[model samples]
Target: MQILLISCTQTIAVLYRHVLEDSYCLFCSISKQRFTCLMSRKTAEVTL
Candidate 1:
């Protein structure tokens, strides 16, 4: 059960990342490193 939950959360994160990148790309030019940092921060928030 726990593993399933974790995998689900990770899948959601990946989908969210794709959406975010697409939207962000439309508005501004952000570097890959910055995008990664943003994603890591978002995932950290979700884990907490």
Candidate 2:
């Protein structure tokens, strides 16, 4: 029973880690897109 519990805990930890990493990946992509848009707008303003 103790062994089973240990395995279950490890599985949960791995799942949690995956979720955290996925969220970080999503956040970075969103931030990068926003930064690119802001840069493009600035360039357009300078040209005008």
Candidate 3:
């Protein structure tokens, strides 16, 4: 009874954590791409 409830709670917690982690990874990847693009443009302008 109690064990079943605890297991259910743990499962839900694990799923939520995974979702948050995935979102954070995606956000970082997008930001990193933007940063590099901006950096390259700046470097090109400097060279020119």
Candidate 4:
């Protein structure tokens, strides 16, 4: 059970890293409006 849990956690971490990389690449390719929208979302998160 402990080994299964460890592998599951590792898989989740790898998936999260891949998602972050993809999102960053997409963000870089987005236009000004999209960039501002993303910035606003980030600021909202910071406020929370």
Candidate 5:
């Protein structure tokens, strides 16, 4: 019973870690796109 519990716990931990990593990656990508957009706008303003 203890072994089974330990395995289950480990599986849950792995799943949670995977979910967190995926969310973090998504956030990074969104922020990167926003950053690029902001930079481009700034360059356009300077050029004008």
Candidate 6:
């Protein structure tokens, strides 16, 4: 019974960690895209 409980806890913890990591990665990618877009726009304005 104790083993079952431990396994369940571990599974839940792993899943939670994966969710947090995924969300953080998504946010980082979005910010990176926005940053690149802003930089490109600035360059375009300078060229024009």
> Which window of ten consecutive residues has the lowest lDDT sum in model 3?
39-48
The number of the candidate with the highest TM-score is 1
Candidate 2, 1-48: lDDT as tens digits: 111111223333334443333221111111221211122122111110
Model 6 spans > 4 angstroms off: 1-8, 18-48
> Alpha-carbon error at 41 in model 1, in Å?
6.2
TM-score of 5: 0.20
Candidate 6 lDDT tens digits, 1-48? 111111223333334443333221111111221211122122111110
Off-target runs (Cα >4 Å) in candidate 4 are 1-8, 18-48
The alpha-carbon lDDT assigned to residue 5 of candidate 2 equals 13
In the range 1-48, model 1's lDDT, one tens digit per residue, is 112121223444455564444222212112332222133223321221
RMSD values for the candidates in order, in angstroms, are 12.5, 19.9, 19.9, 15.3, 19.7, 20.0
lDDT scores of the candidates, listed in order: 0.31, 0.23, 0.23, 0.25, 0.23, 0.23
lDDT of model number 2: 0.23
Residue pairs with backbone overlap in model 1 = none
What TM-score fits each model? Answer: 0.21, 0.20, 0.20, 0.20, 0.20, 0.20
lDDT value for candidate 5? 0.23
Query: Best lDDT goes to which candidate?
Result: 1
- Tens digit of per-residue lDDT, candidate 3, span 1-48: 111111223333334443333221111111221211122122111110
lDDT of 1 at 3: 22
Q: Any runs in candidate 3 off by more than 4 Å, and if so which?
A: 1-8, 18-48
- Cα lDDT for residue 22, candidate 3: 22
Error of 2 at 23 (Å): 16
